[model samples]
Target: MADDSHLRETPLSRTELLRGHFLHVVRDTVRMPDGAQATREFVLHPGAVMVIGLLDDGRVVMERQFRHPMQAVMIEFPAGKLDAGEGSLACAQRELLEETGYSAREWAFAGRLAPTIAYSDEVIDIWFARGLTLGERRLDEGEFLDVFAATPAELQAWCFSGEVIDCKTLIGSMWLQNVQRGEWVLPWAASPGGADAGESGT
Candidate 1:
């Protein structure tokens, strides 16, 4: 079993299938672990970050965005794909501000989640933001979403009732549970201005 576990597939050749604005797809011929050749196709993503914004009143900021692929509105933490050469923390902060019109004075790196492991190389860095101050939302053109706050208990209820089906948010709820129960520890850093309002939500 140990010897089999060490086996790995080696890519022999790769061909670009499609390159879009944010996603790149490629097909590769690889030498399989069992000494067989196979073709694999996958999307290459720039990765992303999801921000769990916890307010002073114990509510979390969430977004209801219409996901075209799903053909439904998804209730999710404010998140976005990383911009070119952007750091994960920067992306998280930007996404929270852009999508929800809020900024946090404290930031913690909760963890990471792989949303689609079977087909795409995508990684989402999970973040917990607290000490929030309302700010004007700077959404991208054509991006439309409704932002609102929900208590942790309410969010959990939605999760159990099949209302919150987003994979990342579900995984994030697990992290929230552990963190709230003192089973997990998150190291937080002070954001610039530390709760002072330099922007307006209006």
Candidate 2:
């Protein structure tokens, strides 16, 4: 393996720029690998999880919600950020239920993704759910979304046509494609052991 210490930077000092209820911004002075000082600004996030839910009819569960930052209605998989001290799998399950009103009998840990590595320390765990059983939704206050299902081909077409622009969702589609083709295999479990979400009626 190649050595990476030559690409490292050491933090000298950090300053808080802003701290919103859910977002934190900070600026840091760091010593670059060449011993030169530089300033870096970024956001601190609590991390998140996204689920790709499989249904009996060969469709995958999805959602449509308006993202304030994008000023657009985005197509996304069910997902949410982790609460304080919450396990990733637990948060995934809670979010899947609260947002979409569905649960899974089997769960799989897909992978992890860092969507905005250049500006934020945010990571989202990718999950796949099956064995769905739907119920009533329990959306969070101020949350508005529509839960739906889409065929893998439909989703891939949308992604290619630029209709679905959410980063997590785009990656989710790629994962689904590979998984469906048997190129990627997930370690599925019946229930949460320490960590993993889905869809049915709602």
TM-score of each: 0.92, 0.94
- On TM-score, the candidate that comes out on top is 2
Over the stretch 75-173, how does candidate 1's per-residue lDDT look in tens digits? Answer: 998888988887888788788887878888999998898999878999999999998889788889999999999999999999999999999999998
Ten contiguous residues minimizing lDDT sum, candidate 2: 193-202
lDDT of 1: 0.87
> What residue pairs are clashing in model 1?
136-200
- After TM-score superposition, the amount by which residue 33's alpha carbon in candidate 1 deviates from its true location, in angstroms, is 1.1
RMSD of 2: 3.4
Prediction 2 TM-score vs. true? 0.94
Query: What lDDT would each prediction earn against the true structure?
Result: 0.87, 0.88
Off by over 4 Å in 2: 193-202
